[model samples]
Each structure stands twice: as structure tokens, then as C-alpha cells.
Target: MLTDAQLLAAAARFGTPLYVYDAAELDAALARVRTAFTDTRLFYAMKANPNLTLLARMRAAGVGFECVSAGELARAVKVGAGGSDILVNGPAKSDEEYAEGARLGATFIVDRAEEVGLLPPRSRVLVRVNPALEVSTHDHLATGAGGSKFGVPLGGVPAVLNALRAAGHDGRGLHVHIGSAIRDATDFAAAFARLSELRPAVGELEVLDVGGGWSLDADLDGIADQARRAAQVFGAQLWAEPGRYLVAGAGVLLSQVVGLKATAHEFVLLDAGMTELIRPMLYGAVHPVLPLWPRSEAALHNTGTYDLAGPACESGDVLAREVPLPRPQRGDVLALLEAGAYGAAMSSNYLTRPRPAEVLWDGEWRVIRQRESVETIWAAET
Candidate 1:
């Protein structure tokens, strides 16, 4: 929701490879989800952009946190999230995760069956069940496929429940997360329908968490209705964990084009690439480019095809391919749209490159996270 002027202004002040988040967009996204799921409690999946500032904002907005690691749990705690406000989830959780999660009185989302044994006795829990259905997303993002490692198969839920009961744990209900960026609304219906079949043997429940994997433009009204109906059948409270959907569209990665090159493929080299935003390189994510020029709209009419290459040494360092943009110069700034979620959260110091700074645009530009310093990159080393 930021104008080109605001984006360019942030880039100019904060430097290239900067992340700019629109506060209005964030509020709008939360409002949409709340409106659609009027009765359901919404949790923000912290893995999608867990900047402390952002987490604090979400917490202030009365959004709960879904943490998958010790660090994320600590972040939630730092932001004053209580046990009831946190849902600890992850496959192969670490000892620290269990210990911290237990100490904080957070609900554990049991991933595998054996995880039940590791939980604190009589702990509140929700067993994650894999629907094992195909969804419209990248192969790596498909957690519900038959062979996926995310959750126990659909057939294994009853046994896990029995185990939870045997272990003296308070297993409230069930949890099912198909995958990320699921484009099909029918996927939710089919998956939920399949899950509903287990209601007979599973019996009445205390909660039914229909995990979130909705696309930015997914039909929330339809999805929320399906989820609510499933929860109603179980006579339980509905819960959801929306990760990327809440934050992806609110962000833009500001990268300066270093230059153009003519090689085996035409390339527009950028300072920000795999290190800054790896979603594109990781999963063929297509981030549209917007050149910061008064005549940019006109320039799109006169375009050229090129790969938006990054400074990474690998040949697969291209962020986007066959991108059509006006010829870019060495100092041209380009805004990569929809780089918010999984953008800064997944960035790394690969090749000793420092991660970019992040700024929030509420009304005025506010520095949320300063760019990582060079000395701090290796300060942890001996």
C-alpha cells in the first residue's frame, strides 16, 4: 500500500537491500482475517517475519503467537504473550523448545506420535494430523502429501490421541496444516472433509485448529466457514495460524540494480539477491519488479526481458527470470513486491554479507531493525 515515493525514500535513507513494511497493510490484513473469522481466535505464525518490532505490534493488536522454536518462544515471551496466547509447534522439536514451551505454560502442537512422550505430563496439547492431500504449491511447500514429514498421517491420529490419553496429557483436539501458499479453496474443503471423517472415532473435542496456508488473495470467507463448520461438528473452539498471508503483501524489498550484463542470459545484477530474499531462488517465487522512476509506467510499455540476478556466486543466484522491465542503470532502485513474509526472516550472512535493515511505514518511516553491522557478523566466532 506504499507509494513509489515512500519506497524510494526508505531506500535512499536506509540504503539498498532494505525491507520496508507498510503498517496500514498490516492492519488491513489483520482486519480482513478477523472480519472473516469472527468467532475464531487468530495466531500469527512467527516464522514468517519474526522481527521483534513486528511481533510486538501483532501482540499489541491482540494477535496470538505460533512459535516453532526456542527463539520464537522467547520472542513471544519478550512481547508479553502468555501461555494461553502461545502455541508451540514444530516437527522434531528440540529439548529447549519443549522445556521453554512447558515452562511458559504454552500449548504444544504435537507433531509426531512420539512427541507425546516428550511432553510435560498432563500438558495441554493438540495432535497435528497430516491430511496427505495434494495442494497447489511448490513441492517443498507441500506438507500434506502422503510422504511428507510434517505431521502424522490421517490414519494415525486416533492412535496419537490414545497415546496422549495414556500419557496423562490433556489432548484437547486436532490440528491440520496442509501447506503454504495453497491457491485452491477446494483444497481446504477436501482436506477438511477428509478430516471430518475422523470426528466419529475422535469424539467431541475442545478445539479444532485448521492451520493456515492461504494465499494472499485466498477466499478467507469460504475457508473460515469451512473451518468453523468443522469446529462446530466437534463442538469446539476454532483456531488458525496465518503466517505469510498476514505479512507478505505488506512488504517490499528495495534493491539497487548494480548494473546490466550480457552473458549466456541477459541479467540485471542487483545488490540484493539470494542472501536478502531467497524465496524466489528457493521456490521459483515470482516477485514483480517496479523501477523507481517517474516514467516507470511508460517504461513498462517499452520493456526488455532479463533475469534479475543477484551477487551470489552460484549460477542459480537469479531471483527472477524472464522479467520484463525497462533497461536499468547501475544506481537504479527496484522494488520487489510481496517480499515481506519469509523475506528478512530467512535472510542470512552467507558469503559474509550482512542482512538488510527493516523499516516500518505507519505514517512516517520508522527504523524497526537496523542493518546488521559487519563486525557483528563474525563476532560470535572464536
Candidate 2:
């Protein structure tokens, strides 16, 4: 694991409010999966981290890209991700996006029966089977559960297949993504078994997409094993769309401590708030937090269970609530761990707080994304 000092040095040289990604770690993650599941097509879900550098790296590693929107598809293309090698998903794609995806020669996962007509003749398409399988995770992150605006429900599958047969849609694959940040491999195993059961209905199934959601904070070896099991069960060209698992633990948010306040309660205020890293407040997400430099060398403190917040004026704007870590003082660097995914990408200019830069670490450091300045924010403002 890279030390916080290295990250802080990169931030100090490049400037604070940064999304620093470890390129080596990313390669290691891909290598782990490739080595474990030799026969599986590891699709890097671009929705998690669409940085061209990450995309290009994954592409160079001989992995495919999974996209949900036109912008994501365009980003993959910009990074040499072949259109033919892309998988287009998402339930609410606009006609323009669908046409663009078809024009680019990308494969799409049809989420609705009506959209089957939108695909071109001989179009490479997959049927997204919504098992309505509920997993133990945040509700907002659960997509396959019944009542969510995700893939076609299980009961609707036969109708979809019938529709495909009627419309002459050449469906060549099955796609299922149950949830995000999934900690249990059994959820995936169950979903894979269900897809396997439906294989007979989906003729000549050339692809079986076990969509992304592999959790990074937990033991991922279990995830690897489950992926292998899925490949074995499906017995088709297998695909795993992993987003956070690929980069969550490999990246960190480097924010400088600005002030400490003990008003109604003690708080370690940081310059990075919901504007920079919104996972904590937005989804009530928990990212292991720590100070760059421990306040004492003798022993670690109880972390005081204080809120680590930002300078944003909004009362709801906070990074972590009641997080326990070494009490941080003014000007100390606070490293929010496990923020590689959905951190900087979800950033905003709310409260007019300018976002930070991004850097990539590969033994040596390089500036990947430049920090945003107040002037940069105003440049687009009317």
C-alpha cells in the first residue's frame, strides 16, 4: 500500500483537492482477475471512472469497456476502446444515443421489449434479464431488485424473448446487473444460476454479462471465485463489468484540513466536502478515513468519532459523519480511503466550491487531472 505521504506530496506539488489514482494498483487488479479467470472477458465499466488514462490502460490490457450512456461510449472510443468491443447498457437511452451506438457498431443490452425494434438488423444485442434479485446493500445502489428502473423483470423475460422472435432480433447474449458495491458473492452466484436457467430460451447465447458491482472494501478473492463459478456455469463467452472493484481501493481523496471547530460538537473541517467527495452524504457511504500524519507518535487516538466536513455553507454538505480517526489539526492533510470510485467523478460546483485536480501514481507521480480554480468555475457561469 502506498503511504499517505506520497499522496500528500503529489497533492502539494500538483495542489490540493485531488483525485489521485494508482495506475500500478489498477494494473495489478486487472492482472489478478485475468490470472484467476483466464477465460472471462473482463469488461471495465466506464461509469465508475471514465478517465481516458484508466480506459486506455484497461484497453491496453486487452479488456473490453462497458458503457451505459453515449458520453460513456464516446469516452471509451476516445481512449481507443473499439466500438465493436463495447457493451451498451442502461434502460433509458435516448434515440440519438441508440442510433449513435448502432452507428458505432457497439453491442447493446436491450432493457425493454419496445427497444428491440430500435436495434438494426443483425445488431449484436443482449437481453438484460432482471431477476428482481435483491442483494444486501444500499437501496439506491440496488438495481436488479423489483420495482427499480433497471432491466426487464423476470416475468417479462418470456415476453421479451417472444418479442425478439417476432421482431427477428438476433439476441446473442444475456446481461444481468443486480446491484452496486455488492459484498456477497452468493448474490452473484444466484443471479448467474438464473441466467444459466434461461440460456435455453436465449438461442446460441454467445455472451453472458455478469454486470459490475464487485465490492472493493471487502475480500475480493471471494469475488474472483464467484466470477470463476459464473464462468463455469454460464459456459458461454463470459463478461464481468467491474467498476468500483477495479479502482475503489486503488484511489484516494487528498484534502487539506482547513479548520477545526468545537461548536455544538467537535468537527474536523476539511476543504473537500460533498462538492469534492459526495459518497458520504449522498449515499451515506462509509469510506475509511485517516490523517496523513498521526497527531502523536506514541500511540493512536480513538479518532474522537467527529464529523469530517467541508467549508460548504449547506448544512447537509458533509463528507463523513461521526467518523473515528486521529484528531486532525489545522493544515493537516486528511486522506479519505477507498474513494477511487464515485469520488471526483461525482463532484460538483455546488456552494460555488471549486473542485480539485487528479493525479496518477505509478511508483512516480504524474498530473492526470488539473485542479479546478475559482476562475475556472466562473468561466462558464453566465
Candidate 3:
């Protein structure tokens, strides 16, 4: 939990539309998960928030990493993660990524039959099985459900395994990820039960990669119970790649109100837009937006609903719709809560807006990522 003063100070020093991450909060989230899943091997999905500072902290906490690309693998290595401590998972891995994974001795979560052929001889691999389990989440985030491009279908797992064996790769495990932002433990349990039914075909599983999709407010105890059950049924080591669960609440995006519009519906415009934080616009996701400074009694009592919007040209750049807030004045800062997950990771520079700076606050504040300059943004152009 960041204080309003702290947020204001950060915004003042680093400039508006900045990202602030609480290191203590991140460690606490990790602790909570560890306490719940005592025996499960936890892997931090780097895609959630890949700031090097955060990665270094995760490494210090003894958590392994789940890398989805060559760039992520390099980040893991840069953060001092051992080759064996990394797990490579992605549907569109390049030839270079496979060779790099082989070089790093990382476990590969094979999403397709061809992926197995790409692995090094006798390399450790886990077949990602798409069980087509429907999870209570956004349709676009659903991965294990039918028609998803994430994993090999359950019926296709055997063939993938055979191909792995033929390629001299060690096919020793199974992986399943229903979707992102999963809110129910039963969904995970059901997927695990389905995996149990396929045990006969998978054979002697050594690892069960129960992939990550946990919501920010998901029930950890229930998830732990079901994960334990899955471990028992499969007789294998339990593994989870938690991305959002470990980091979502540890961050906040700080934006300052630039202007106000007296439209049919009141609009509070901010300097931050889709380029700085895209979740709200991209997935229609809702993030709690609160004024940094306390409002007056009269302002709070006489509040009206306003559409909180950004500076982007797109009409979809609205962050919150018809949300009741005390009247916001220009230059007032707002904090977008629960933004530690996909917030910064999925940000883009659309409209040529430079990305914002990122600060890590443990006991003190330090800039982790500096605000991008226009020159830096255009440095690659010929």
C-alpha cells in the first residue's frame, strides 16, 4: 500500500504517468503463495512484469522463472537465474529460442508437435495439453479452451509425445493453462481431473506444469488444495507459472488530470493514455482510480459520475466509465490500482508517445526504468 504522499512525491520527482512498484508488497504476495502451496515449485512468469529490478528480487527470493521468448531468457540469465532454473514456454518460439533454451538447459513446455522436434536431443520437455476447459474469464484471455492457439489439444498430446521420443527428447511431464484471470479453483480442479484421466496415455509423468491464470483476488487456499490433489493424482512434482497473482496489486500507475470536459457525460482527462497503460482500453478491464489527495466534504457529497479518459486519439481510450468521483481539478494526480501485472508489460508507444518511467519503492524510492526520450524512441529508424 503506497501512501498518497509517496505517490505524489514520486509523480513530482519522476513526472506524471509513472509506474510505481512496491517491493515489499511483491515479496508479501510471494510469501502468501508460498505459504499456501507448500510443496509446489513456483515459477515467476516474467511476462507479467519484466523489470530487471523485479527479476533480481525474484531471483533473490529463490523463485524460478518462466520465459516465453529469447529476450525473456536473456533477462533471466542477466538476473543470475541458472539455466536449469528456467522454463521456456511459448507457442511461436523461434529456432533461435529453441537453440538458446537447449543451451541454457531450460525445460521446454512444448505447445505443438513441431516444437518437440525443435528441442535438443534428450532435452527435458513438458507437453502443453489444451483440455478445452472453460474458465470464468475474458474470452480473449482463455487459453485452454477450444480454438485457443496456446497448447496442443488433449487428443494431440500422444502424437506430440511420440514425436518428442522419436526426436530423442525426454517427454516427462504435462502442462495445462485454462486461461488468464481465472477466478475459480474448481476450474483448475476440473482441469486437473481431466489431466488425471489422460494419465494412461501420458505415462509416468515426472512434472505437472499447472500453468498460471490466477486472478488478483483469487482464492489461494482453494487453489492450493486443488493443486495438491493434482500432484497426488499425477504422482509428480507440482509446478505453477503465476504471472498476475504475484504482482498485480504491488503496482500502481500514477497519472495527472490534464483537463475536464463538460460533455453530455462529464469527462476527466489525464495525460496517461493507451501508450502508458493499455489494459483498460485493450481488454475493457476495470482498474480502481482514486484521487491522490483527499477530497473536501462538499465535493465528496456532491460528486457526480464521470468518464475518466486519456489523451489518446482513440475514443476507446477511456479508462473508467460513469464512475462516481469527487470533482477532479486539473493537475490532480490519480492512482490506477491493481496495475502491477499486465500494465507496464503490455504498454505500447502508439502515437509515438514515449513510455513512462518506472520506480521501485521498498523502503526508499529508486528509478528502475527511466522515462523514454523521443530521441531514444526514434533511435532505431534509418
Candidate 4:
């Protein structure tokens, strides 16, 4: 994590409405996962925060890339990732994505029944198993829920694997991603135990990817122990695709207070809103706030609560609700914590709001991604 002085220096130099990431924190997060799961291969889920520079860093650290689209694959390639270093995943894939995956020799995560025919010849594959177990998290975040359109159901796994082998592809093993932000460790224990039941069905395997959804405060070693048991049952290597867990705590969205409103409810409107960080609105995520601007020692005693609001027409643009603060004023700066993952990747130019710039802190501030210009957003449009 960056110090308050460092965050303020970044805001002063780069202006408000910017993202600041700590290089040391990123390395530490990766180390924590590696230290916990010593024998497993780690793949940083690109959808979380796919900054090219960050991708290059992960690549340099010997981490593979898990991409869901052609663009993400290209980002991996740009960072010098080889074909075998990428995993092409997602249920609804395009022909172009297939072509790109094949051209790169990437492994395909077989999702549904029909994908068997669409895969490239002799491609290595892992059939995704939807555990269909109810885990503790938002419904939208539960990719393995009973009706979620992510992976094939447990029963359908055999058919997909059989079809994959029949199509002359390398049926390496099985994959199960219960969901993201998982709260219950038992959820994983159940999924892994259930997968062990497939021993007679899947037989001995090469890779057992128990997909990552372990919460930030999760018992990683315990979860890893459960995963090891499942992989040992098949005598396979374990793989994890951690998205939010790796980068969420290492980044922050630095925005300034534009004005304060006191109506039906109080709001501290800022330039960064749903356009910059939507996890709050999309997933009911609550991000911690840190005040950066100097507050007088006298007035510091008078603290108040405010809902951090963004500059959007929709009322849902509120980034956080009922946040305690020191009565922020115009031009005051604040940092939205735990925004490294999914914050930038999910940001849109909705209502023509140009995205904020991103900076990385590695003893000094470096701009990884520059702020988007208004013209560029509409330049591609007719």
C-alpha cells in the first residue's frame, strides 16, 4: 500500500481522478499466493486489471495469462507471452477468438457441448465443471451456481471430455471455478470433494484447475490443502486463475471532492463515479475511503458521513453509501481503496466520460495508462 504522503504527491503531480498502484504491494500479493500454494501454477486473470505494463511484470515473474477474449489474448502476446502461456477461456467465444487461440497454440477451456467441434485440431483442453453449489457471494459473481451459463454441469463433464478426446484434442483434465469473492471455505471443500468423486469418470488427469474465488481474507493454505487432495486423487498438477485476490489491495482510485450535497441524503460528489469504479453498483462492493487533503486540526474533531457520488445522471452513480468522513470540501482529495482489480477493466465511456489515468508507484510515479481524451472516445464513431 502507498503512504498518504505518496498518494498526495501523486495527486499533486498528476492531478485528481487518477489510479495509483504500488509495485511492491503487487509483488507481495503475488508472493503471498505463491508462498501459500507452493506447487501450483499461477495465472493472473486478465479481466481483473489488464494494464499492459502490469501484464509484462506478471509475465516476467513467470506467471501465465488467462484471457477470455481476442483483445486480452493480444495484450498477453504484446507482453511477450507465448501460445502455451495463455489459456483461452469463456463460454460465449467467437470464431475469431478460436482462430487467434489456434494461431497462438493456446489451451482452450472447453465450456459447453458444441465447443468440441469449434476447437482447433489437436488443441489441449480442460473441461470446466460447474459445481452448481451455492456459495456465499453475489448471484452475478457465482459462475458455478446451478443455472449460471459459465461451465458445463457436473453430469455434462464426462460428455464434454469424451467429445474433446474424440475430436483428437488433448483432454488434459478438469476445471472448477465456484465463483469470485467466495466467503465460505467449505464451499471449496465441498467442490473439491465432489470433484474427487469423478475419479472413476475422469480417470487420472494431468491438470486439476480449481479456479480461484478465495476471498481476500480467505484461508488460502486451508483452501490449498483441499485442492491438493483433489489433485492428488488424480495425480495431477494444480492451477489457479486468481483475479481480484492478486491486485485488489494493491491499487487505489484517487479522486477529488467537487462539492458536497445535503438533500434527502448527503453526498460528496467527485469526478470519479460509476464510470471509474462500478463494483459498488454492479456487485454491491464496499470500498474503504481515505482522506488525503489537509484537514484543519480544529475541524478534524467534527467528522460526518457522506455517500461518495460520481458525476453521472443516474442516481445509481453513487460509488459508496454512508461513508464516515471529515466533512470534505471542494478541491479536497480522497482515495478509494481496494480498486486494483476490475476497476479499470470494467470502466466504460458511458455518457462520454473519458476514463481516468493510471499511475504506478515504484519509488517514483510512472504513468502506465494515460487519461482518455474526449475526442478519442468518439473518433471511431461515424
- RMSD (CA, Å), each prediction: 1.2, 2.2, 1.2, 1.1
Model 1 agreement with the true structure over 1-382: per-residue lDDT tens digits: 8998888888888999999999999999999999998888889999999999989999999999999989899899999997889999999899888888888999999989889778977789998988889889998898888789888888889999989988899989999999999999999998889889898889999999998989998999999999989888899999999999999999999999898899888899999989999988788788878888556567767778998989989888888888877877789899999988999999999999999999999878889998998898989999
User: Each model's TM-score, in the order given?
Assistant: 0.98, 0.92, 0.97, 0.98
Off by over 4 Å in 2: 217-235, 298-303
lDDT for predicted candidate 1 compared with the true structure? 0.90
Taking the tens digit of each residue's C-alpha lDDT, what string does model 3 give over 235-278? 89989888888998999999999989986879999998787778
**Least well predicted 10-residue stretch by lDDT in candidate 3:** 113-122
lDDT, model 3 = 0.87
Tell me model 2's lDDT, rounded to 2 decimals.
0.78
lDDT of 4 by residue, 1-382 (tens): 7888999989989887888899999999899999889899888899999999899999999999999999999999999996768999999999999999999999899899899998878999999998888889999999988899988888888888988998899999999999999989999999998888888987899999988988888999999999999999999999999989988999999999999999989889998999999999998988899998777886688788889999999888999998888888899899999999989889999999888899999887899999899998999999
* Tens-digit per-residue lDDT, 48-145, candidate 2: 87778777888888888888888888888888876668988888888877887878888888999888777776667878888878797888998888
Q: List where candidate 1 sits over 4 angstroms from the true fold.
A: 296-301
Position 148, candidate 4: lDDT: 94
Candidate 4: C-alpha lDDT: 0.91
